[model samples]
Target: MTTARGDSPADETGGLTRVLVADDQALVRAGFVALLDAQDDIEVVGEADNGEEAVRLTRQLIPDVVLMDIRMPILDGLGATRTIAGEPGLAGVRVVILTTFELDEYVFEALRSGATGFLVKHTEPADLLRAIRVVAAGDALLSPGVTRRLVAQFASHAKQPASGADLAELTDRERDVMTLVAEGLTNAEIAGRLYLSPATARTHVSRILLKLGARDRTQLVVIAYESGLVRPGWQ
Candidate 1:
C-alpha cells in the first residue's frame, strides 16, 4: 500500500492516499496517474477507460479515491459513480469527478449520484490532490464557486417534492441535525451549534442518514433545501 518511495499507506493513506483514474482519454488518464504517482505518498492502484471497467476495478481494488471523468465512451462518470457508491463492498471508495465544462449540470447530478466531489479538468494539481485526500477521509469537497452555483440551481430546480418524506420519520433532534447539515456545518460545528458533544452530533447525523435514505451530507443538504426547511437567506 506504500509508494515506491517507501511511504507506507498510512502516511500516504492519510497524507498521500490511493487513487484510481478513470478517463476515456488515454493521455488525460496517463497524465493524472503521473501527477498523482509523483507525490511522495500517493499510490495509483488501477486505471479504467470506461465506467463499467471503473466499477469492476473499484470493487476489486477498493481504492481510497476515484478520479472519474464526466464524459466517457460507454457509461458516463455519473452512472459509474452511482454504481460504485451503490456497491456495498467498496464502502470507503470516494469518488471525485473530473469535469471539462465549468458549472455544468451534470456536475450537480454527479453529486446526487453520490460523488464525494468534483474537479475541473484543468484544476491545480495541489487542489485535486487535497480533494482526493479530503474525500478519502469521508469528508465532502464542496468547491465554493461550484457549491454556490449548485445550491442556486437546486433552489431553482428542486421543484419535485423529494421522492418521499423520509423526514417525517426523524425525531426532533434529528431534524435539528439535518437543518445544520443542510446549512453546511461539519460534525464538530454542528455539535457546537447544538451544544452537544461531537459524538452526539455524529450519531444524530448517522441516524438522519439511515432514516432518510441519504447517501451523504451532500444529499442531506439537497433534501433539506428541497423540503423548504433550509431557506436561502436563513443561514
Candidate 2:
C-alpha cells in the first residue's frame, strides 16, 4: 500500500525511471540494459544474471520496477518473485515478468507468484516504458489477453464467485471504478469512459483502493472479477 518517490507527477522529476533487469542470459541482460538506458526518462540501475542475484539487487537498490525473466539459473523467476514479494519492508517494489512466448505456463505462474505486470521480449520501446511507469505508479499493466486471461481464470476459481460480495463496504461508485480497473482501463481511459476529468478519475481510483482496503489496481482487479462485478468473456 505504501508508495515510493517516483510515483509523483512527471513534470517536476528529471531522472526519469530507475529499473533493474534480471535474466539468466548475459546477452538478454545486456540487451535490456542497453534498451532501457536509451530512454531519457528511464535508467538501468542494475542487472542480475540469475534469480537469486535479482532478489539481492532488488533489496539493495529498490528500483521503480524489476524486469524479471521467467527462466533463470540459481533460482527460477517464479521463486525469485516470491522472494522479492515476500521480502520484509519492500512492499513498494513492483515486479514485471519478461517472456518470449505469451502462452508459456510460467507467465501465469509468475503472476500468481507475485509479478505486478508482464511483457514480451519483443515489446516496443514505447510500450515497455509505459509498462514500467504503470508499475511504478502502482498500477498493473494488464494488456487484455496477457493479464485478463489470468484474472478471469483466477476469479472463476474463487469460492464466492464474487457477486454480492461486501468489498468490506465500498460505495456503488467506487465499485464501478473497480470493475473498469479490472477491465484494464488506465486513468485517462476510465475518465473518458465515465465522462470525468483525469484528476477525478485518479481520485476515484484512490478512493476505491481506500474503501476496499486494497493495495493497488491489481488487487482491485482480483476483487472485481472474483466478486462477479465483472464476469470474464463479457462483451
Candidate 3:
C-alpha cells in the first residue's frame, strides 16, 4: 500500500531532495517521514508499505532518493531496486537500503541490485541525512568501514579476472585516483592527497565509473581488487 501525501511546494524546499519512504511497518514509515520532513532540504513525497508500491510511486513521483527497507511483504527491496535500476528514466534516482543488520547477505545483493548503499537502521539521524545527500549527489555511500566489511565479505567471490586491457584504458593519474577510491577515500580526501580540486577529483571518479562500467564506487573497489589493480594487503 502507498500513502498518498500532498506534494510539498518546490519553492518551500529550494530544490529539495524528494524522498519516498518504503517500509512495511507503519511506525517506521512515520518516523522516517517525520525525520526527513523536519529537514529543509529534504521532503517526504510519498510512502510505500511494500516493494511494489515503492516501485510504482517511484515511477510516478520520480524522487531523488528512496529509503527502502530490505524486508517487505509483496516484493523485497532488492526486487524493487532492480526494477528501478533497469529503467533508464530512473537513472537520476538512487535507492538507499535500510536494514536492522549491518552485514546481512542482503546488503551485498542490494548493491548488485543497484542500491547506492545500505544503512543500518540504528544509524544516527545526522548520518542518515548525510547518506541521502551523498547518494543524491551521484556518489556511493561506501564509507571506509562499509568498504572494509564489503571487501571482507566478497573478496573470495571475485569475478573472472580483469584483463590487462581493463587497466590499459585508464591513464596513470586516473589509475592513481582509482587506487585511492578503492581504499575508500572520499573525493575530498582524494583531492587533498592528489593536489586537485574536489570538482576535479569527482570528475576523475565519474570518468572511472563510466570507463569501467561500474554502477558506483563500491563496484569500482571490487574492480580494483578483482582486477589486481589493488591487492588485498595494499590498503
Q: Pick the candidate with the highest TM-score.
A: 3
Between the candidate structures 2 and 3, which one is better when assessed by TM-score? 3
What's the TM-score of each model vs. the native? 0.84, 0.78, 0.85
lDDT of 1 by residue, 100-166 (tens): 8757778777777777777899999898877777777777435744654575566557445533657
lDDT of 1 at 213: 76
Q: How many clashing pairs in candidate 2?
A: 3
Write model 3 residue lDDT over 67-127, tens digit each, in one string.
9999998899989998998798888788888999877777766776677788888888899
Q: Give, for candidate 1, the lowest lDDT window spanning 10 residues.
A: 1-10
* Candidate 1 off by > 4 Å: 1-16, 155-165
Superposition TM-score, candidate 2 onto the true structure: 0.78
lDDT winner among the candidates? 3
**What lDDT does each candidate get?**
0.76, 0.74, 0.81
Instruction: Tell me the spans in candidate 2 whose CA falls farther than 4 Å from its real position.
Output: 1-14, 137-142, 157-166, 211-213
State model 2's lDDT. 0.74
lDDT of 2 at 110: 65
